[model samples]
Target chain A: MTAVLEVEDLTVRFYTEEGVVTAVDGLSYRIEAGETFGVVGESGAGKSVAALSVLGLIDSPGRIEGGEVRFEGEDLLSMDESELRSVRGDEVGTVFQDARAALNPVYTVGEQIAETIEHHLGYPPSAARDRAIRLLDRVGIADAETRYSDYPHEFSGGMCQRAAIAMALSCDPELIVADEPTTALDVTVEARILDLLAELADEFDVAVQLVTHDLGVIAGTCDRAMVMYAGEAVETAPIEELYYDPKHPYTAGLMSAIPRVGDDDDRLPTIPGTMPDPIDPPPGCRFHPRCPFAEEACTRTDPALVDPETGEAATLDDDRAAACLEYTEGLSGGLDYSVEVAGGTGEHVEKTIDERDEGGPDE
Target chain B: MSLRRFVVRRALSVVPVLFGVSVITFGLFHLTPGDPVSQLVALNPDVSAAEEARLRERWGLSGPVWRQYLAWLSNVLVGDFGRELRTGRAVSGILWRRLPETIVLGVFGWAFAIAIAIPAGIYAAVNKGRLGDVAARVLALSGVSIPNFWLGLLLILVLSLYLGLFPVLPPSRLPLYHPETLRYLLLPGVTIGTAAAASVTRVMRTSMAEELNEEYVTAARARGLPERTVVFKHVLRNSLVSVVTLAATLTAGIVAGSVVVESVFNWPGLGSEFVRAIDRREVNVVMAITLVTAVAVVLANLLADVLYAVLDPRIRYD
Candidate 1:
């Protein structure tokens, strides 16, 4: 498989009145052709900012300081405004976090999609409208031809997201940056939306950069995933590997924190401490304040992403890599954690990771 | 179909509002210390008490407040505004003659306000806090603060006296629809529209600025839409909803401003007639003008309500 987008050493900054905030620091990731790449993290992890920077969408007071966004071998960052405009809806489409808010209130859903089609594909309004209706119907909006003239307010949250998804796919772009596409949706609706996204990504042969805070969302949809914490990726691995055997302590904490359906415990195990302020982050490691496996060295040594096998610096091609002192400078106490996959076969009741064996599920 | 229903419902709702306004005007007239008959008697010293009594009976001014209001309302409904005390001329006829002039002036002012305010507001919003925005804001501030009477005089002084652009007297013989009258309309139009333009510009700026930040704008931009399309097509539509709301209120300003603006322009409009009627205490003429102005303001607000539903799809008139 070939890489469709290669975002390297991306750094985004916001020049706020208080101070300059380094929102995304040296973030690096890539999405291969037709592969769903997940960028999972807690809130304020700079997922959306980094995604926006790919399209050169950062406005005043916020700037994309440094980045090489190579989309199909072309450096998008070097492109001028007009050049970027040609690439935006033509080759890359974006679905905003808030689907309803992302849709223009005054315009009909079909018109909004058709307009992008008209602009990017050079189709006339009639052709664009037909294409938009078909796309809307394909995205699962019932009576899409009739809903063609319906305004955004007339659509429910789920329907709006479906329309937004339809819009993203309208131009037949090579890539889609869905920034928390299901965040504002109902719990039941989120699953169906994710399924639709994955199905359409495959159908349209488009790569997706799915940004979400939900690990379960990534686990079910993404082929490969990168776990980000405090604006930095701590681990990058295949979805199953990341879930079954998390490399970073933060990822393990996240995996363990997923509450099980049948678990008797009222309190869900959580990763302690909040995301550190971007303006003035901790000295050594950003996540050390919250890491349960933090050693004395973790407080002093800032680790770069390296291979666990050879402890050498990992390249973009490396499938499994982690940025921890254990993988780089080496932790004195050594890192150890066991993942407990409860139940048998099909759907599991509980699958959580914690320190030590702690025994398997009694059931 | 629903839009038509909404329009009918909204239009029907205006009846009660206009009736209430007419009632208030009549009640105020009735509650005053001297009745119109007595005032008329006082003005003409040669009038006998029997003649005054006959005038009172004829005018139905001897009834209670509600009855008086109803009597006045009944006459007004059928376009009978009584007759001027001094001239003994039909107040309705005088009103119809002056009404068109005021309507033209008001329309010109309204048009001028929209033309200047919409563009100036869009410019300021698109280039917020920049030099153009700052300049537009300053101009808008001055437009709102400066009184129409002062602005009218200044416009006449400069455009009529210094620049030689227009004459002080409005074109009298030329039909108002004639092109020559338009040139004469400009001075007072600008004078009346200045405050409204300023008021609307501020609203447009704030409304556009807010809409510019909405996610739809960024979404539009993300779709490879030219920056122009994002700002003009998407942002402008959302911003106009607020502008329409403010437009309704600015009508009051323009109407009130016309009163002063008319006198300064020496335009034969209802506003100038209103001033004369007040000065001479022509109770019939004054009451007719006041009721007309009140109805106009009520209608403007009603128009705004209808426009609000049209501009924003979420607004349903249930």
Candidate 2:
């Protein structure tokens, strides 16, 4: 399938007073047509910065130093200001996390959404407003016609997020970059919003690049997942393969960290250490300082992502990969794969793989 | 209660404060070394002792101090400013005639400042850190730092001397009511207004800059709204409360600072009348001018507070 959105070797940096801070370090991923690609990372992992770079919104002192963000086969980085406007809402819409702050307080929700429609699609005021109401209705807002005139402050958090989603879909853009859309919501609201996003993506035939830190969310909504560690992707694979047979140590640690819903365990599994500082990040492998199975070479040389030798039958379409030294040698060799790697072919007669490296904790 | 009620409450509270202010002013004027009666008698050496005593009685200076205070206060409340001892002219009449000139200068000065400052401030903010912003900042800094008196003198020298525009002194040849009289007023008004305009523009620019950085601005950009529409229609209105409040307070300050400007230009305004009243030992006129000035300040501040509440919903009267 053709890639709907492709980010190639994206690097974003900020020239601060102290020094140049690397926010995103050579990140690369893609979302296929009508697929949900989840980029999971912590706050400073440059997820938002990467999204802003796609929209050409990076301001002074912070910039896309090196990257190509291809949205629907068009290079966004090379577009001029006027050209970028055509792409921003008409081609690639965005739904920010903080819905209350994202929407203008002075304008009614319908007015705000209608503005996007008028600018991008050239809809007349009446038609644009009707479209706004229809979009709001589609997003589960009741009394869509009447409540369309209400300001952002009058809406609840969940309702505001829904309105923001409606605004994002106003122009029916091909790609939607939802930056931490459900992070600020309660558990119930988060589930509803996630389900809403999934349903909308299917109904609209639009690709979604969902930026989130929740691994479970990635498992539920994303076709593929990118695990980010200290501004670099540690693993990228189909969701089931990533959860079942994660190869990178960081991905393994992340899986172990998820608490199973029904497990009656007193203590939950956790990964020790914090994300490395972007400025003066660990020289070789950025994750070496925190990796439990770090070798001397792991600290001296960055491990490049390569296909693990899982034989012809073991690989998934020859794309799923991990950035770890253990994966370089034979996968079934006597390596310290303390974490279990679950759900692969059992007929490949080879050396033993660690049984403890099983599937990710179930939700 | 509503904002209108709050303003009334605040305005009413000022009366007691003004009373305290007036008592202090009256005591200071009386406690000074020179006695007005002795000064009057010394001016006319041929006056006999009985004749001088009769003159003092006529002016009510012969009354006990407490009775004199009560009489002066009662007369002031009734709008009967006592006659000046030297010229036998009622101080109220003098103020009524001259107050218009001061009001004229102040109104024109304030209007000019606000007209020029608002757009300049918006430009400076939109083009921040650019050449226009730099130039505007430098102009404002100069306006603030340069003394108004010196600036008035320089304008008089440049515009009056080289161009032969306005008169060196006020247009005393023509009655102040004549049309040509405005030319004389313009130079002084501009001198007083420049500093105020500069300060107002700087404040507006700072506020606009802050509003532009808000998350809503980012969201607006994300929605594909044009730059001009985003700035003028959205950011400017959101940021207006602070700028309007600054301009209002600055205009009030200019009213007070006009004392020096009026003196330098020799325009027959309240400040000139005030200084002359002081020199002539006219206590009633002096006290009345002080009361008027205090009232002007309090009212101006009240107007600013009221406007703030109107412009920003976040502002509420407690």
Candidate 3:
């Protein structure tokens, strides 16, 4: 079966006055139907830009240089504006970072949802309103009927996100692109919103592209995840596999950086340096500057993403891949790392994977 | 608070503002070099002192300034402005006759301003940095920079003297609402409206450009709304919230512009009469016009607050 969304060699750039900034470069990933795929990156990783490119939402001064965004077997890039628009809110709805900002201040929350229903589904205003009210209620908004007419400011941050989720699901789209849906929320509110998003995605049976910087968020939510660095995907694997036996050193660094609840580590380990400037990145691996395991070859050559286990070039069908000289050209010193999962009360048994020797915990 | 309550509160606030204006205006008029009856017959030395005394007493001006001010304020509260010293006609009666002309000019000026500013502003913003936007901006710059009197004279010279498109003076017999009145109104209306329209256009362009970058605009477009609907149906209303505030200021601006504008066009409006009353020290006419204009402008601001609420749901009086 065709994947719900297929992005191949996607490249996006912004033509600023200073020079061209390649925001997203040669990035590719596939999300299967009813799956949650997380795109994890720092601020300048271009994860959001890649997602926006799928819906043709890149405005002027920023252009989708080249890419093939195939949505359910259709190339969304080649479609006309009108055709693309018809598919956008109907087939692939979007939830943005700032929920209140995403919703228009002047319009009522319910009418905003109904507007999409009326536009794409051919439902009359009254019928659309009824459906929208049902959707708001489904998204856990109590008194959805009375709340439908309330503007965005009247809703709390969490409630605004709920209403946004309702609007995204209003047209019953097959794919929902939620870009950091809980970034603006409080920690207490963040958990509830994320759970609500996961629950709704399951209930609706829709694929979600969850873009976030939090590894914990990806750990608890995603089925498969891709790690992006310097506008490129560095690794891709199943969520559990990536967490336990991460193929990329950057991904391994990310795993260890998360503060564990069971163990009392005063200062958590963190990646050494910041991401390289995107406008002019390092010549070799973008992560080489920060990688503790970087060898001479890593600074000399750029490596393509490949299946580390089989030493073959990575494809959308490949189950696991890592873009590193160790996986392709064979590093002189060899890559060594271990992941230890702390078991709280033995419910989640302590498990460790050391790529070099399968050693028990870190010596 | 509800719209009605908001409106009522705003309306009631106008009272104190008007009273303050009345006191200031009365003080300023009294501070002028001459007494009220001086313009009447003070220059006429052939008249006896007793005649002047009797005239001052009859008009109730033979007292200290504060006593006279209290008298004027009391009379004004009951819709009775004192009699004009020159014509002995009721100040209210004189104002009632001349106010319609000023109202007609002001309405036309505002109509022309709004009609021009809204479209031009939208176009300029939608096509920002394009040739059309540059042209509209240049026009707006010229509109703001040019003085109303100079523009008024230029219009008369070009439209009346050269083109003969309109008569040099407003037709005396034509009713203020007549279609022919529109022809006579063009020069003054454009003159009064040019600066306001220009300022409004700049504001509209800025407000719209800012709003277009708002996340909601992108979200609205993401919803598959057509460009026209996204711009007009969604962004336009948000942009107008700020423009409405500027429009309120422009209301007073248009009314004030009429003083000079009415003189240039030789229209028999309160503005020209107001200038005459000022010269002759017709204190009653001056005070009446000042109070009326202050009240009109204050009410205009009230209307703006209401419009702001209508356009933006977030605004609340409470």
- Top candidate, metric lDDT: 3
TM-score on B-chain, cand. 3 = 0.95
TM-score of each: 0.95, 0.82, 0.96
Clashing pairs in 1: none
Q: What is the clash count of model 1?
A: 0
> Model 3's CAPRI class?
high
**Which of the two candidates, 2 or 3, achieves a greater TM-score against the reference?**
3
**TM-score attained by model 3:** 0.96
Off by over 4 Å in 3: A344-363
How accurate locally is residue B15 in candidate 2, as Cα lDDT from 0 to 100? 83
Model 2: residue A199 alpha-carbon error in angstroms = 4.0
TM-score between candidate 2 chain A and the true chain A: 0.90
Tens digits of per-residue lDDT for model 3 on B1-318? 776777787778878888898899889877877786676575777877889899888887778988988988899999999988877899999899999999988988888888999999999999999998999999999999999999999999998999999899854758876788888888888899999999999999999999999999888878888899899988999999999999998888888889999998888888998999988778889889988888889889988988888888888635
Model 1, residue A239: displacement in angstroms?
A: 0.8
Task: Report the lDDT tens digits of candidate 2 across residue range A12-109.
Answer: 88999888998888878878889998888766878888878888888878988887888878888888888888888787878888988888776778
Better of 1 and 3 by lDDT: 3
lDDT of 3 by residue, A52-90 (tens): 899999998899989799999899999999999998889
